[model samples]
Target: MSDRAEAAVRVIEGSLRKRGRLRDSHITLAHGSGGKAMRDLIEDVFVGSFDNPALAALEDQAVVALSELASHGDRLAFTTDTFVVNPLFFPGGDIGTLAVAGTVNDLAVSGAKPLFLSCGIVMEEGLPVEALRRVVASMKRTAEQAGVYIVTGDTKVVERGAADKLFINTAGIGVVPEGISISARNARPGDAVIVSGYLGDHGTAILVARNELALETQIASDCQPLNGLVETMLRACPDLHCLRDATRGGVATVLNEFAQSSGVTIRVREAALPLRQEVKGACEILGLDPLYLANEGKLVAVVPAEAAQRVLAAMRAHPAGEHAAVIGEVTGEQAGVVVLQTVFGGERIIDMLVGEQLPRIC
Candidate 1:
């Protein structure tokens, strides 16, 4: 492995060893009472796992030097997201992993290298303390894997029925390298549209985990950090026109946003889209469109046609994007619209949904 890769592995391994055991089976109101109990919980759980000089200080805020930030890029990218997925635990990941990956992906797709994060966690009074420890450990592992740090955080406890078992809000900061100006409006006519991998895995996995449809299938949420994958793609195609994570509204919503922002039409081929067998089956049974489902780890890239092949090749080389494909292209005709050619050879416009199809799946 490369030196950088080896270092990352070590970080994750060290974090795993530092995780603290939570002795309390269940949480109580005192854990959030801003007293000794709260102090012990924070020190033993979050700080123990996410050990680093910045976080070790236990200050009200983290201070990063300007030179340290300037060395990475000329522009800073900042974003925040809240994760409240029902059923705190899922097949492949839990709320903690989702919280970290979601925020990291947001920064990554903006052509940035994610660096720091602040986490705010809310726990219900009666929730299991062990469960909180597990989630915090997961977050620590994910941050190490992503090469970012959780520098500051806050914890709150609410009445048992006033909140869900747990909820997490994360704010992230990253550095956008010089000469990299990726944006939805940068997409132009003839730009090739690429999807990193299969769609709807996350939405389908959450649906099955909830057991709301009485369906049984082995599908795991595609919740993962995409910064490493995005970094590889940028190396191959530095002039990438646009990049957007296929989150809440999935690939379809991302494409529509690109079309509207760039004032160009996006034409996607139905057969070219990639979907896992389980996801396809679930969508069929649920009478839902896979294109509109949510995905946590996937992203859509629009680059010049000349660089599409190189970028796609680079993406496929990464583990996170093994199923990457060139699914469509941008056009000047029918501006501000997205057209999907059906498997039956019919074409139809894809519009943004007036209401959400799946709520709190992310």
Candidate 2:
């Protein structure tokens, strides 16, 4: 490993100081050997932190009783994510919340109702036990709030000099109800493009927290699960064309992908996109565009012109979609292009980001 990597490992180990009750000089290979050391580690650390009925069972696979969900014969949607935010925690949430939210949104944007999640954690030899515990607890809480269960999990501890403090991977499963279709390929010309709320809050908040950059206003990450909001919108606008969470490359990349996949053009008005004052200020200072920054809580939707009002109204009624607006419209011409109409009436092409503006942001 390089000097910086070595130093990072040392820093992580330094954080895992155990006092009176603990009796290990440093994490040994035995800790991961699946023997006594491993059992003790699981019982004392992993289980102690994420203890719940499902996890406590310690079964190879959870015996889920999903009669209510299974009886409907809804198509299942599944997604997995790994989170390695450098700061571990950010303004609105920590890695735990991000893991859950990311998974939930993935299923939601696919027109699915999230059901359960399984977490896998890799811990460095010396991460603070309390911090790990807090993360797991937060994950449980967030999953509950999102109406999902953390049904199973696995834990592994690496050598003191081997890894970062924590890395969490989560896999989730959900059911897609019949008659609901949503995807990038569903967008069509004349469809109205809508966003649930303000953009770039998550990315801006993370930048501020990680760099300790001082600004006049506070920005909190918009990390949240959109399953419920999607459900409401589906009820209000059953013919909704498409849905997507503006993550990673944000609204620009998502729109571009839709245009390419569905063979349509998206014309967005710069003045119509909603962004918080604090987020806008931070983006300006950082030389970032809110349109390309990541968001965890917000969603983009495409609906027929006749269904736009009902869809927007349904979104606004939900807490997650209060700032929803019709930001753009799909066009038959200029296929595979995303154009932004500036406040001065000039048009510019918005393309996928060549590289990530912020790395390890989610």
Note the Cα lDDT for every prediction shown: 0.92, 0.84
Name model 1 segments beyond 4 Å from true. Answer: 1-23
Q: What overall lDDT, based on C-alpha atoms, would model 2 receive against the true structure?
A: 0.84
What's the TM for model 2? 0.88
Q: How far does residue 36 in candidate 1 sit from its true spot (Å)?
A: 1.0
So what's the TM-score on candidate 1?
Answer: 0.93
Write one digit per residue (lDDT tens) for candidate 1, span 30-57. Answer: 8899986687687788888898888888
lDDT of 2 by residue, 1-362 (tens): 99999999967754453211234644555666777666555565555555567766768677666777775446888899898877887778899999999999998888888987888888788777667756877787788779888878777888877877888999998888888888789888889999999999888888888775677558889999999999999999888888999999999999999999999989999999998888877877778889999999998999999899999998899999999999999999977999999999999999988876899888
Judged by whole-model lDDT over C-alpha atoms, candidate 1 comes out at 0.92
| Candidate closest to the true structure, highest lDDT | 1
Report the backbone clash tally of model 2: 0
> Where is model 2 more than 4 Å wrong at Cα?
1-31, 40-53, 65-68, 212-216
